[model samples]
Target: MATQYDRIEPPLARFIARQNIFFTATATGDSRINLSPRSTDALRVLDDNRVCYLDLTGSGSETSAHLLADGRMTIMLCSFQGPPMILRLYGRARSLFHGTPEYAERLAASYDGEAPLGARQIVELTADLVQTSCGYAVPLFSHEGERDVLTRWAMGKGAEGLVAYRAEKNAVSLDGLPTGMPA
Candidate 1:
């Protein structure tokens, strides 16, 4: 069975707050659907109908591009260690670049050390529907803290290296759409 809400209720918001990770999905016309496993600590539930996440510099900017073109995005979070449940947020999302005021405001209030090396943009989402279902098939695995490999790599790169890396890998989507990434 599944349940849906026009806005995130107290219990639903609590569940979202307890999760350590979330997944994001997006796509555009004729472009490849992008599903990224972003189990970061940067997501925040803003009130009952909004959520935001800090998207790091990755190899592809599909999410950014798709959001720009279509404004469609879905974020999913599953209980990996506790009860078996899956929460999905369907919404319209907008990507805020680093130099923009919106990005700065949201990033400042998001999390400590969120704007780190290789930081790219913050995705602000206005969720239209919140759904939860029994995740019977979801395998449970205890979290052992976030992996430091990516963090270490980004730290090693420093700010200058990160800028170069973004230029080479994250400037465009797989289908050649501009991701609105800051240069």
Candidate 2:
């Protein structure tokens, strides 16, 4: 069975805080739907109806591009250890790219003025519907730890290299949609 809520309650917020991973889904009417697994301590619940995450440089900027084309997005999380629940937040979102004041403010307020190397943008979502379903079928797996490969890779690339990499790889989605990354 599934339950729905208008906002993230206290318990739900706490549940979100404990999770080590989450997934994002987005797309435009004509574009391929994009789904990606995300980790790192990148997510923040701003309020009962709002959330934000630090967007790092990656091979594809599909989420950003899809949000630019259309604001619809869904964020989902499943418990892999204890509880058997799946949480989904359906909402509209926007990507605030680097060098923008909105991104700066959000980073300072939610991320404590610290963003990981190769940080690309801040994706803020205003969730209108929150749903939870039984995740009994979701296999349980122990969380060993987060990987350091992305941080190491970013360090090796350096700031300039990160910029160039984004221009080359993160500036557009696989479907040729612009991600709004600065040129």
Candidate 3:
């Protein structure tokens, strides 16, 4: 059975905090829908109605592009090693790029000066609906650890190199949408 909630309850918060990975889903009016798996301790719940996640540089910037076109997003998390539950956060979101004032403030407060290299955007979500369903069929898996490949690559390239790589790979989505990337 599924249950809907007006806000993120205490139990849901506990469930969210224990998850190793979460998925984000988004789509524009005409473009393809995108579902992305994200990790790296990037998510934070600001309040009952608001949440934010840091967007690291990757091969594609579909989420940023899609959110720019349409603010809708759904973030989902499932218990893989405990009691069965699937939580979904449905909301509108906007992406704040590195050059923006909001980005600076967020970084200063949350990351100080040690923000991740090649950081692209921060996605802020305003939740309007929260739901949970029985995830009895969800497979149980143990979390090993975070992958170091991306961090190592970014460290090797440094800042300027990362900017160039973003230009080459993260500037646009496969459907030719602008990712709000700085030039």
Candidate 4:
């Protein structure tokens, strides 16, 4: 069975804090839905109805493009090594790209300025509905640790190289939608 909440309560917040990874889903009316797994210690629950995460540079900008076209987004967190549980936040979101004032505000207020070299943007989600479902069917796997390949890659690329890479790879989604980049 599933239960819905008007806002994220204490228990739900704790569950979110314990998770090592989460997934984001977004889409526009005509674009292909985008779902990506995010790994980082960059998530923050601003309040009962608000949450934000630092989005690192990646192969696709589908989430940013889709959110720009349509504000709808869903964030999912599941327990892989704990008791069976899945939490989701459904609401509207907007992406604050690097060099934007909004992104700076979120970074200052939420993060500790320890973002990685590939940090791209901050995605803020305002929740209207929170849902929790029994994740009995979710496979239980032990978390060994996180990989540092992305960090090493970013270090090798350097800032200028990362900028060029973003220009070439993260500027647009696979659907040909502009990711509001190269600004």
Candidate 5:
């Protein structure tokens, strides 16, 4: 029912590219685990063992904080459109801040040199393990499309407003951990 691999094979990469949403799970030694559902075209499979996703401006930056406190991260995707399958990538992750050369390079390579509006950082993960399981119990759902609310909100907030908003809301996690976004 389950199998493990050292890296993401080509077929797995294709499966990931077709996924409309994925989940990220992370935590520190003493902090609550953070699990989030991410959508849009923000994620990219950089290589057989590396992946990156554009971190957008959200209400909280728990993933960023957890990654900073403890590098362990896991990304999971379940098949909803076709045959039942589940994939998980276990790895260490780091957030690449804007203005850094790493961030710029990732943005260019993964995002076609255009950073989406309200994008604050890039979360890159280097996988040590990949696992696949039969998602027999998973229910099927069709991906209608990406929502534009985030984009519209970012547009309304503009650049300066987003900066201020992040400073106020994204700088700290719910457990009082610093996300290193800016305070």
Candidate 6:
């Protein structure tokens, strides 16, 4: 069975926060699909209809490239520790690049006083529909700890180095799509 809403409700927000991992799905009009497992204290609920997350440096920038091409995204969260449930946020998203005015403004408003180290982009999600389904068959897994390797690597690079890393490693998707990463 399935249920849908115009936006995320209070209960859904609570459940999302409890999730240790979430999956992001994206695709262009024609290309390879991308489904990525994301973790960390990166996601934030801006409101019932809006969400945001920090995009860190990675080998492939499929999500950013796909979003830039198609603007559609689906984020899924499933309950692993409690009753069986799966929540999906279907929406359009825009990737804010690092060192841009929009990125700076989002950082100011979203990050408060402290800055996020090696922050590359802030993906702003505007959900058009929220859905929930029975997740009776989803497997359960325990979270160990947040992966610190990315953060440590980014920190070791410093700001300019991180930018160079993005140019070298994150500017293109595996499928050769341009991610529009900062220069």
- What local distance difference test score does each model get? 0.86, 0.93, 0.88, 0.89, 0.92, 0.87
User: By summed lDDT, which 10 consecutive residues of candidate 2 come out lowest?
Assistant: 33-42
Better candidate number, 3 or 6, judged by TM-score: 3
Task: Give the count of colliding residue pairs in each prediction.
Answer: 0, 0, 0, 0, 0, 0
Answer with 1 or 5, whichever has the higher lDDT. 5
Clashing pairs in 3: none
Candidate 5 lDDT (Cα, 0 to 1)? 0.92
Specify the poorest-scoring 10-residue window by lDDT in model 6.
110-119
For residues 64-181, could you state the per-residue lDDT of candidate 2 as single tens digits?
9999999999999999989799999999999999889999999999988899888999999999999999999999999999988899999999999999999899988889999898
- Residue 76 displacement (Å), model 2: 0.3
Top-TM-score structure, candidate number: 2
What is the C-alpha local distance difference test score of candidate 3? Answer: 0.88
User: What residue runs in model 3 are displaced by over 4 Å at the alpha carbon?
Assistant: none
Which of 1 and 2 is ahead in TM-score?
A: 2
On the 0 to 100 scale, the lDDT of residue 33 in model 6 is 93
For residues 52-165, could you state the per-residue lDDT of candidate 5 as single tens digits? 999899999999899889999999999998989999999999999776788899888889889877999999999999999999999999888889899999999999899899
Which model scores highest in lDDT? 2
For candidate 4, the 10 contiguous residues with the lowest summed lDDT are 107-116
When 2 and 6 are scored with TM-score, the better candidate is 2
CA deviation > 4 Å runs, candidate 6? none
Ranking by lDDT, best first? 2, 5, 4, 3, 6, 1
Model 5 lDDT, residue 13, Cα = 97
For candidate 3, the TM-score is 0.95
Q: What is the alpha-carbon lDDT for the whole of candidate 6?
A: 0.87
Using alpha carbons, what is the TM-score of model 1? 0.94
Cα lDDT tens digits, model 3, 1-183, are 999988888888888989999999999988999999998288888789878888888889999889888889999999999899999999999998877899988777666634688687888888899999999999999999999898898899998888888889988898999988776
Report RMSD for candidate 3. 1.3
TM-score, cand. 4 vs. native: 0.96
